[model samples]
Target: MNPVRKRRFILVSALVVGAATVIGLVLLGLRENINMFYLPSQVNSGEAPRDRSIRAGGMVLEKSWQRDELVSTFVLTDRQGSEFTVRYEGILPDLFREGQGVIVEGAIGADGVLAAREVLAKHDENYMPPELADMHLERPK
Candidate 1:
C-alpha cells in the first residue's frame, strides 16, 4: 500500500482502539455503582450476593418490627409470602411502618440477615417507587 493509505489505516485503527478503551472503562465504573434490586423471595432463596451491595424491596411484615436502643429488626415479605430478616442501625424514615412498601440497601450477612445501610419508605398510595414498580409488585389488598 502507498505511504498515505498505510498511515490512514493506522490512524483509523488507533481511533477505534481508543474509543473501545474509553467505552470499556466507562462500563467498568458503572458496574461498580450499579446496585441491583431484589425481592424477598430472591433473598430467601439465596439468590442475592452475600457480600455485595444490593437493594431489597417488599412490604414490611405485620407485627415484625422491633426497635432497640441502637438497632432495629424487621421482616420484609413479598406478596408470595417469602420473607427475610433485616437489621438496620440507623433512624428509619418517618413514613416507615409495617404493612407498607419499603426498600433497604445493604449487603446480606452470612447469617441470612440483611445489614441495611439505608432504608426508604414509599409514602403515598398513588405513587410507587421506581424500583418496586420495575418489579411489578402490587400493594397488599
Candidate 2:
C-alpha cells in the first residue's frame, strides 16, 4: 500500500470514531436529564420509574393540603381516582390549591411518597385572571 493512501485512511477512520464518540456522549447526557411525565394512576400501578426525576400531573385532592413549618404535603388524584402523596419544602405558588390541577416534578421515594422539587399549577383552556373571575365575559360565538 502507498504511504500517502495509508495516512489518509488512518485520518478518516479516526474522524469517524471521534464523531461516533461525540454522538454517543450527547445521547447519554440527554438520557440522564430527560424526565418522563406520568399520571397518578400510572404511579400507583408501579408504571412510573422510581429514583429518577419525573413529572406527575393530576388534580389536588380536596382537603388533602397540609403544611407543617416549611414542608407541605398533599395528595394528587387522577381522573380514575388513583392518588399519590407529594411533599414539597419550598414556597408554593399562589395558584396551588385543593381541587385544582397541578403538575409536580420530583422523584418517588421507596416509601411511595414523591419528594417534589417543584410544583406547577395547571389551568384549564378557558381560565381567566383572578381579577376577571367576577366578571362573566361570555366568549364570542
Each prediction's whole-model lDDT (CA): 0.88, 0.89
Candidate 2 backbone collisions, by pair: none
Residue 129 of model 1 has an lDDT of: 77
Q: Would you give me the overall lDDT of model 2?
A: 0.89
Reference-based TM-score of each model: 0.62, 0.64
Query: Best candidate per lDDT, number?
Result: 2
Task: After the best TM-score superposition of candidate 2, give how far the Cα of residue 101 lies from its true spot, in angstroms.
Answer: 0.7
Give the range of the ten consecutive residues with the poorest summed lDDT in model 2.
Answer: 132-141
TM-score of 1: 0.62
Clashes of 1: 0
Which parts of model 1 are misplaced by more than 4 Å? 1-36, 127-141
Write the residue-wise lDDT of candidate 1 on 1-141 in tens digits.
999999999999999999999999998999745644788888888777788978999999989999999699999999697999999999888989898999999998888889999999966557767997767756554
